[model samples]
Target chain A: DAGVTQSPTHLIKTRGQQVTLRCSPKSGHDTVSWYQQALGQGPQFIFQYYEEEERQRGNFPDRFSGHQFPNYSSELNVNALLLGDSALYLCASSWGAGTNTEAFFGQGTRLTVV
Target chain B: GENVGLHLPTLSVQEGDNSIINCAYSNSASDYFIWYKQESGKGPQFIIDIRSNMDKRQGQRVTVLLNKTVKHLSLQIAATQPGDSAVYFCAENPNNQAGTALIFGKGTTLSVSS
Candidate 1:
């Protein structure tokens, strides 16, 4: 089965620009989560969408938001981006939103803020 | 393959040797732990996972050990090969978070030399 997929393998945007990244969950999966990975760090949780609603969020600010479609595809939107917002955006999908569920990840969208 | 981190904690191991990557999680209530391998340019791939109820779990060429006593988790790769060179990360699912997001550790880079 096709695994999780993300759009725009790489993106470049200037400060204050708004960018949108898209993700398709793995076949048969329902829950989608977004993560931000800096150059030397592990992926940090951004937020998670389940049943088309944002169920949980990390310490990120209002500038970072997301939407999940009925088909299980999701979008991560960053408004008024800053240089610090540059990172690899990873999308992970799982069969359910539960502690025991394992997640499958997408290749990720590399966002470069100039 | 994935892009290499700007600076990684590298583990240089000889072929056929065993390599271990360790991670310490902050949430004591984390119920699931996972190990992911990310090659240069690609997304993180699931290696193995272990649940809180179990102290250890084994996969084809990898084993995951969870030490709840110390909130520590580790990934052990057997008979390390050059193809096994990649960054390994451990992720934990904190308890009762509606998002079911994973908190990741700073990754450990593994370099297998033949």
Candidate 2:
């Protein structure tokens, strides 16, 4: 089975520009979450989408937003990107919400903001 | 084939030796913990997980130990091999949050020398 898949493996955007990243969850997974990994740091949770609605969000600013399609594919959009926004964006998929489920991740999209 | 730890605290281990990676979580409410292995340019991959109810769990050659009293978690690798060299991360889920979202730790790079 195909695990999680993300598009635009690598991206370069100028300051104040907007960029969109996409992700397709693994087959049978209905929940998708986004994370950002800075250089030499751990992955930080951004938000999670379930049932086509954002169920939980981290401490990120409003510039970051996401959408989930009926087909289980998701998109992450960052507006007015800042140089600090340059990092690896990771997409993870899980089943239902609970303490028993585990998430599967994709290769991630590398975003570079200049 | 993955090298997620391009720049981080590294642990060098001799081939066939046992390895231990440590993590200390700050959230006392976190009940579920997981360990992930990430290679260069790839998303984190699940290794093992343990809940607050259990202090220890074993899977194949890997084991997870949780000390709820201390809010510490660890991953032990038996007979470490070259393929086991990767950045290891510890993630925690706050009680009811389940697997919806996870908080990750700054990752430790494992280097296996033959």
Highest DockQ among the candidates is held by which one?
Answer: 1
DockQ of 2: 0.59
| Candidate 1 chain A least-lDDT 10 residues | A94-103
- Candidate 1, residue B25: how far the Cα is off, in Å: 2.2
Predicted chain B of candidate 1, TM-score versus the true chain B: 0.90
Off by over 4 Å in 2: B1-8, B96-99
| Model 2 C-alpha lDDT per residue in residues A9-71, reported as the tens digit of each score | 999999999999999999999999999999988899999998888888988999999999999
**Measured by C-alpha RMSD in angstroms, how accurate is candidate 1?**
3.8
In terms of lDDT, model 1 sits at: 0.88
Deviation in angstroms for B56 in model 2?
Answer: 1.3
Minimum summed lDDT over a 10-residue window in model 2 chain A is located at: A95-104
List DockQ, one per candidate, in order.
0.71, 0.59
Clashes of each: 8, 4
Q: Clashing residue pairs in candidate 1, if any?
A: B1-B40, B1-B41, B1-B42, B2-B39, B2-B40, B2-B41, B2-B42, B3-B41
Question: Each candidate: RMSD to true structure?
Answer: 3.8, 4.1
Local distance difference test, each candidate: 0.88, 0.87
